[model samples]
Target: MKNIRNFSIIAHIDHGKSTLADRIIQECGAVSERELTKQMMDTMDIEKERGITIKAQSVRLDYVKDGEHYILNLIDTPGHVDFSYEVSKSLASSDGALLIVDAAQGVEAQTIANVYLAMDNNLELIPVINKIDLPAADPIKVAEEIETSIGIDATDAVLVSAKTGVGIRELIDAIVERIPAPSGDPKATTKAIIYDSWFDPYLGALALVRVFDGEIKKNQLVKLMSNNEEHQVLDLMYPHPLKRQKTNAIKSGEIGIVVLGLKDVSIVNVGDTITDAKNPTAEPALKYEPAKPFVFAGLYPIDTDKFEELRDALNKLKLNDSSLSYEPETSIALGFGFRVGFLGMLHMEVIKERLEREFDLDLIATAPSVVYHVYLTNGDMVEVQNPSELPSVSQIEKIEEPYVKATVITPSEYLGNVITLLISKRGMQDKMTYLNEDRVMLEYSLPMNEIVVDFYDKLKSISKGYASFDYEPIDFKEGNLVKLDVKVAGEVVDALSIIVPITSAESRGRALVKNMKEIIPRQLFEVAVQASIGSRVIARETVKSMGKNVTAKCYGGDITRKRKLLEKQKEGKKRMKSIGKVNLPQEAFMSVLKMD
Candidate 1:
């Protein structure tokens, strides 16, 4: 236990955290160079294609220093804000963290956010400057920025190029020297905290846990602290990048996989404690709160017959990803579906893509919305997750929308453009500070709904990809919010409804109707696309009827004959307009996502 080092790599997205992990693994001789692959920690294809780590992975390595053999357990964490919960859990199981900052980009928004998380966990921090091989790499400037902004000593920061394996030996040596070894008692009763879990068809549910006290061996009876469910441990193995090595037992201050022979993955919950069933301890391991979702949206199948399949898919996915939550819901325009909640827009996109790719199901996702507190006139409070479920104005008193404290880090050259972008999104400046002469950090309070859509994309565009953003939910505040509904030919399209601030509802509605007119195919009769707020139409667009010149049949006919034909055609059009039904394409349901 004294020679065991548990640590995790934390950094902002695209900062080469995964590459660093690969290099460290290679340096530790965990795998040979010929067998090694780029981003070995990223096991998912989506992660490789997107160049991001979606899941947290763990690996154990053996390193010898000064003739002393040591066990190094490294947890590779996701860098995106959406996956912060994973990072927190990884930190909970570690004694220290390797803070990797890009050499050129310096400290980014996520870097700052993750630093606070590590500090909150009281984990020792080791600063590491990555990508030193880049032509524009400036390790000195980044180290200075870290010292000034994070108030951490970075003079001795490890400088390395993960791609070329330069300075990897020095980083390993630093890890062995700087990170404190895990402290626990092997003689105590078994108590372990599960940081992550997944379903295995052959072995049933498997839990990845860090043993804090005592030992767990094969065929031992164990209990889950969360639900008090008891099961026999069928097997144990050490976690590796490529394969799991069978172990007779896992001792204190070590990470390993536990198999209970349970087919249902829900039985093995993440963040739950595992203890001896017969000789249980009085106190369980430290409990960690699950990640709460910030955005909610409805996912309906394009084919209504797949509702049950969709439900099964979500259930299976939840077994692997505990953060995903869904409940059965039905829409008037769209048939039966589920109202799914996600951490952010990227999280939602990943889930949707997974469902389509893994389960082979086509899905239609409604516009994402934030949770709103509705104070009814009848002295009742209701939480609204779907815009179509918003109560009528007559039944409500006031609406409160969720807000977030957002932090934006960028170069000083784009400070003006960033401020303008935030202000347009109804953001109020909360604070501002200069990390140095070239970098600025700005804080703002913005409504969650405003930033939940295309805020990140727009911010990146305006700042020319030099700005990074991160936000956390704050308390809900009273806002002049209204439910904007779209009516196509006098019928409300529930899927196209949204909640918007009163000030921007008119413009948003007009833009939505204009986009609808361009995308919605014209019918035989004129179609009216109207945007309304509480039965009052605010914007309208008319899709002209597909016309056929009635007078063309009689080009040289008399004036009276032409007049009669024109009148007949007019009457026919009026009848068609009354009875025609618009067949909206899938693009119509997705228009709201692209609406500015």
Candidate 2:
């Protein structure tokens, strides 16, 4: 029998996931008053810079009660909707989950999502309605709402102010009581879940696992069940990478790190299951499935000439993150650009930010487009990622659309208004609950097709930024939405358009084109920016004028400063790919591009 337990802390965005982690670590004696960074789990520069958890992080805490210590393995996961797949994978590794619903916000989309994932994994779920110390907190109502909605009794839900460390003791006790201790024969073959994995400059590749069954120690031969690949373990450790926690063995349900320096670290993927080869365990590792990228955009180096460098940078990015999907694609009009796929818009933005921060390379992007299903003749089914590739009316049979399951949380007074807004957006209510007399829960099944353009911005606007929602691809249904393709200089730019509602096509395209105009940097030549509905251009922007004349009259200013200035200008110009006399800038493409 094992005394240790493993649990994950999951919640909606900004629900204090990192904060609660801090208090838990402190209580476990992992850190002292003088030894902790703010949001220690978020150690990555990108994570701290964005104020979000982009990766799943693991930590081990030794909790003492009456002089008896119970080691608890705690893994913190990204709470954003974009990282839902990562959340699901992390949940797969845990025996239970701590659903940290915000007291003031009650349950948002991710709250429902993380809970659903835990239930699906068949893991024990202990709801920790957090932020109780906040003046706006309403733990009682949150518990009631959770019970009424998910059918999980929140009657005993632990209320905690993770920030103030209030009620943390109770929360820890609840974890030990609610979650099952790790089980299975310690002498048998080992099987573990890769909670998180990343590349290390010195160590090569590192994999963090919670041994669900048997034992794994240094010199043990293990196989990844998913790929049927064998690796010889060279070392073993616990928790943080900085420490070399060499252990002879890890028994069933013990969380630890295993290193296999012999194998190519690149193949050791996160979410993979590692098991001992001897006394083979019949049960395979837990399923590892990456989320499909919903948002599509074009990635082009601004220095139009550094195409190879851009590709290499993306390759390096893919090595670190398994989520990014990219394909070699080109625009006859825009020249060379990559069709990069992302889980969502937030994901795209995060990737852009990372590239800018890390690569120091300028990138240009077009607008994001939704995945479209175009039924063709001869019983052929096609998924159109770019609008310019949409089948002509002759080739297309019936078009199907993607949908999202959304949850809306707001004040009771705003309930009617929120529903009205969703109804207008062609969303159907799936479920509802009363958080309190003053707050309500509203669930809706919204079409993903409708949300392809400006739906998120509109949702924030209508709810006055008080509401939070998330969605996953549910099913495809017949819809009236059609693809609007943008054409620049008579050449169709596939990355420049999106699939949107017929009613708002012209208006949305017009507004987007306006945003694109503001975002797209000026070029050496007068370039045209256009948003088109199919082949017809609905909106267009013409560069007003160029400040410089083609003839440089070649002799002015200090020779050295001018030479330095020319060198800098040349280097800057090289960062952007020049297409048809236009030098595209990275800023123009990263956030708001007219291309895909």
Candidate 3:
């Protein structure tokens, strides 16, 4: 039998996990030069455009070394905190993980968080300190830190560079030896987990799965446990880095593709386990939960007319990302905007960037929100998705909000500043230790809702984007912050803003109106923008039109140019907001840029 191995690469955000993934697939002899592109696992346009692995991807490579064929099942996982649930699911299909760390940055908080997940999954850990060829790399120090922090001996940590292909061979050799071989009963029952999948405009739904046990064959009947959907597997194939080729079926230890699943990509659960219905196995499915959506906001288009178009784009995106949830929501104050939930603030930005960059859409978003539990006097339990629904203390029995255990790793010089900033964000330090002479690591217990909103971005800004932080859900605690009312045009707009400390009511109101002013268009007629805290105006601004200042003006032989300009402006006015008879372009809504 050919030697079979299953593994995955886990690391912090931007630590070259996807890049290392490409190198491993190539070394497996699955893909070739002409057939390969950068970060092949990140096959989606949004994934490539954003430089983040949004989904977990599995690829099969056939390696021939010393005249022996080695079947390698490689699962590429998302490194960002946003996709923790998906990463945990990817671990379910793997027997070991290559903990790729940036040698220069040493061990980061995300690295530690992922390590804990791997340990929880009972997956073997192989520390592979990547980017060793970088100028700032201190392999020895990183090895020592890994030993001290992860409790994994540093002696076996391999120094490798996913960029230059350095130490790749040794890394592969270690995989062939250290990682355990597949031993599950191939004939017991069919079970596999869909690590990641995509919808082909041509091929339908293509799913990449790692067979945990039994076997899956082309044209065989299969069932998706999450939704209980059954389908006939139309085809099966393995990764041909150079060219795709059809495979008959894959055994328990193999990883490959399945198609004609019929169900939409969203129905295919990433962390969900699959098994044969007739001979179902009792093995508990891999223990992993979906990444919690922390950040909340509204998404709207510059041309409210194209609101449907933007919704379609998001629907297409959500087909692949089941974790992203929303419903048709209208804001009496801000007009119609969907209340979006995200894993974190970066997750929110990534969504915005994709909407703008990939689909070529313009969008405006409100401040993010954290989920809150509201308990009523009648014993009714409600999970408040929007901050505006928070019941007053007098009306509620109690409230609970999500909490997290967080860790921050940064240079020693910024230790004091980091702590001050974290404390300001309602983070309480539990432990602080020096990693070496130049670095210090701090562990804290914080509200998950905080970090998922703007805590990550704020921390990076305060630390010059040098500090790395990672967190896992700890528990829930009652919060003291109250929801700030954002009213426009003298009406309460619940979706216009969020929950904030009493002291920040003014600043939050100011920021919201500022963003609206910047994004709201300049109408022909003047429009007043007032950001108030419960009828108290914190800031006010007015958008005044140009008032046909350049209308019908022509001198010399410039008539043709002016006519073209007027025609273009007319089309633009059609796309902009209209107040009375005046046309307001989309850009007028955003007034903060002018202030900046």
- Candidate that would win on lDDT: 1
By lDDT, the candidates rank as 1, 2, 3
Q: lDDT (0-100) at residue 379 of candidate 3?
A: 93
lDDT of 2 by residue, 257-332 (tens): 7777732645776777788776567876676777688888887776768788787677667656678888988876
Ranking by TM-score: 1, 2, 3
lDDT of 3: 0.74
Q: Is candidate 1 or candidate 2 better by lDDT?
A: 1
Give the root-mean-square deviation of each candidate in angstroms: 2.2, 6.7, 6.6
TM-score of decoy 2: 0.86
The reply for model 3, stretches above 4 Å from the true place, is: 34-36, 46-50, 240-242, 261-267, 277-288, 301-316, 333-337, 355-363, 375-381, 391-400, 510-528, 535-596
- Winner of 1 and 2 under TM-score: 1
True lDDT of residue 177, candidate 1? 94
